[model samples]
Target: MSSMSAPSLNFLAGGGEMGEIIRATDWSGSPLGTPETWPGSLRTLVQVMLMSGQPMFIAWGPERIMLYNDGYAPMCANRHPWALGKPFAEVWADIIDAVGPIMDAAYAGIPTYMDDIEFLMTRHGKQVETHFSFGYTPVHDHEDRVAGMFCTALEITSEVAEAKARKADAERLREMFEQAPSAIAVLRGRDYVFEVANSAYQRLVAKSDFLGRPAADVIPDLLEQGFSDLLDRVYETGEPFIGAGVPITVTDTETGTTIDYMMDFVYQPMRDADGEIDAIFVEVADATERHKAEKMQAILNEELAHRIKNQMAVVQAIVSQTLRNAADVRSARQLINGRLVALSSAHDLLVRGKGERASVRKLIETAMEPYGRGDGRQINLTGTEIEVGPKAALSLALILHELATNAVKYGALSVPEGHLDIAWGTSVDEESTTFDLTWTESGGPSVDEPSAPGFGTRLLRGGITGVESRVELDYSPGGFTFVLSTPLADIVIS
Candidate 1:
């Protein structure tokens, strides 16, 4: 080995990768010369950066050549060893736009401290978002003039990511709460001050301002209903309370009128980490409509029971009278079966109407369906649009059914070429409106008047109780004709 002076080891006294690198570095080609010949201020700053546990750096001279401790290498990523001797602008060109102003201020002798400053930097050959908290202070030379800037920085990327994640979670929870179908609210503290009220809750209260107000203040009537006391008990015991179909009368803030409502609701205590009750969560559902439906259902059930009993008695009377008048067992069975079937068909029409008014045309079609063949060429129906209430619909259905059955057995429908024409019209007057309907049979065997009234005959002649109707039957050489006159007020929907 040729004689060459050993490189100085004095810089290694600072003790780290950065200090070791400085000791072995060649500064002969640089403007600042060797590390041994550098000013005391620059050396002192390098020593401080090397010995400290924090990430620190120094940009020196007019060129702002960069120097950094080992702690800063990870932040530099792939630029580490190469960044050691490079100028500050070249080393951090990716974030120069954001860092340039801070550098300028430091150079102007103004110390700056920034927290969670965001920047985009290229690390490991890929651009990434990063956040940092740092302080930059001016470094002095031997003449007590600004020569460089010293900085201590902490990469807060993980902390900021966690904070952003928490914020996103909170926003999602708020959105779900607002859009929930049931009314919901949050009350904080023993006083039950409202913290959050969703849109459903707002609508339930007619959009009153309830936030930050105690429940009693918002709806004083609830206190009288013991709702406030229920919340207190739930909170005190850390238990939940649930109620259904509970009646509460509240005054509408907008209308200034008291309204009665039924509610299904719960008051649930929310506990903190230490298992202490902190607040109450309220969930409510409006049950007023359901309550009304249940009540109406009970009343309807009672009425239906009474109606069924009366119907059974009427059927019993019909069977007994029909059997007594029939000539033999076969005739009696036939008459009973026919009448029962007619009643069943009428009952079906009433059921289809849901106990409301039924279309007159629909009733006729349904009642005569069994007697008519495909396409119904044997019968013709002509009438204006008319609706009849349940009682009239059932009675008319029964009358039509009996007429259709008799036609099939002994009248026009008994022959292939025979035809029945059904027509109805309305006559309106000052005192009342009357409906007139005629059933005419033609192209059948010559007819003869019945010697005695049968069950069907009586049923057609206003025999159905509660039905105010008059009927006339004609037996002529051509065929049979039936005429019906009924008050429109008893059947018309209006």
Candidate 2:
């Protein structure tokens, strides 16, 4: 068999590995035949691709045989050398699904351009992500018919990766800005134009369309509050200013009403690339609720101090009266100490009820708790739920203390077997509402009425003050009994 000699092609005349490989490759086994037998158009296209510095390639004939310049070798990675003289589909089988349609369009004489096309190529024995901007154009033969597809590509993997990283960073920053708790705004330019405002800032100003607008124009009220001046100073001097408890008035867009609020804010200068002050960054924290709470606490403290002084004066009077009425120092001291304890017990109940009204049953139980074990063996209490004003609770507490003291000294609580039943109830008529209480003692030593009433008896009878108040004492041989009746109107109802 005779074979045609290789042609003295200009493209193969270059001193490069690609040119050497082309000139040395055997053409008898190839479907396209020898270089001398190749058409003028294909030869001309190969010469133009070899001399060019850009990355270019040609896939010729129905088999789409691969022919590329030195510039395109790096893009082939480990697949170079072996990739030459092979079909385009075999050289790029990894991305044939993506490049097949583009090649088909080009072969049909329709050029295809793609920007930043991504491919997952298995190069260097590992899959790598790559990107490229490429154009596929039709190559015509001497007969002016589509013969092959020509491709020119530039790798853009690094650029595309950098762009993705930048986009992710921007998205994270936006999330942080939107979710910030404190009001934050970023202004740009010497005019203090609003560039970025978080949700908090939008809520603070009661508006959202502030971007690209001057801060002073968006919030004119800030001009009077000196906030606009602060921004100007920060921008001029490139220094930050912080203010605490600054008052500002804002209008409610929904109600068209003006509201005054206190804010702790800062105006910080933002610098440009040249280190020149360009704008101000504003951060604000609402302190109106905190200020109101502080004011209320101060007033409550003052009121509490005044009440304490009044209570001390009342204690002093009680001490003096008890000392004057006692027969001796020891007696006076014991009486005063017991009375103060009783007073403290009433105050505790009042405190538990927030110093307003106290339950009548709670007052009795608390006053008698120290004298008896709560098992109902020595002292028992029975009553309906009724709330009494502070004054009434105190008076009733003292009266109950006096009655319990008398029982301990000579009545029910004096003996081991002795017991007392303390009960109370309410009665309402058309004319008035009345409270009735009874203290009955049993299983104790014999009782007798005293010719001269002691301080305990006198206090119990006279301590309670109301319009229709009365007390009845019975000194029966079995035990001692006391009954109290009073108008319920004297005590505040709960």
Candidate 1 lDDT over residue span 318-378, tens digit each: 5765766789999988877876786677667756654878888888877665442326487
Which digits, one per residue and each the tens of the lDDT, describe model 2 over residues 1-494?
A: 12223345554567367877777888778877878778888888788888777888889999999898888888999988888878999999999998888898998999999998999999888998999998999999878999998888888889999999999999888788889888999889877789899999999988888799987688887776787778778887888999999999987666778888899998888788998888788889999999999998996686466446545654665566567668999998887787778667755765565367778888888766544344787788888998888777767876776676577667777667898999999889999888899999999999999999854566677746443578899999999999998888776542
Model 1 has an lDDT value of: 0.80
Q: Give the TM-score of candidate 2.
A: 0.63
Residue pairs of candidate 1 with colliding backbone atoms: none
Q: Which residue pairs collide in model 2, if any? A: none
lDDT, candidates in the order shown: 0.80, 0.80
Mark the regions of model 2 whose C-alpha exceeds 4 Å error after superposition.
1-28, 32-54, 69-71, 120-130, 300-494
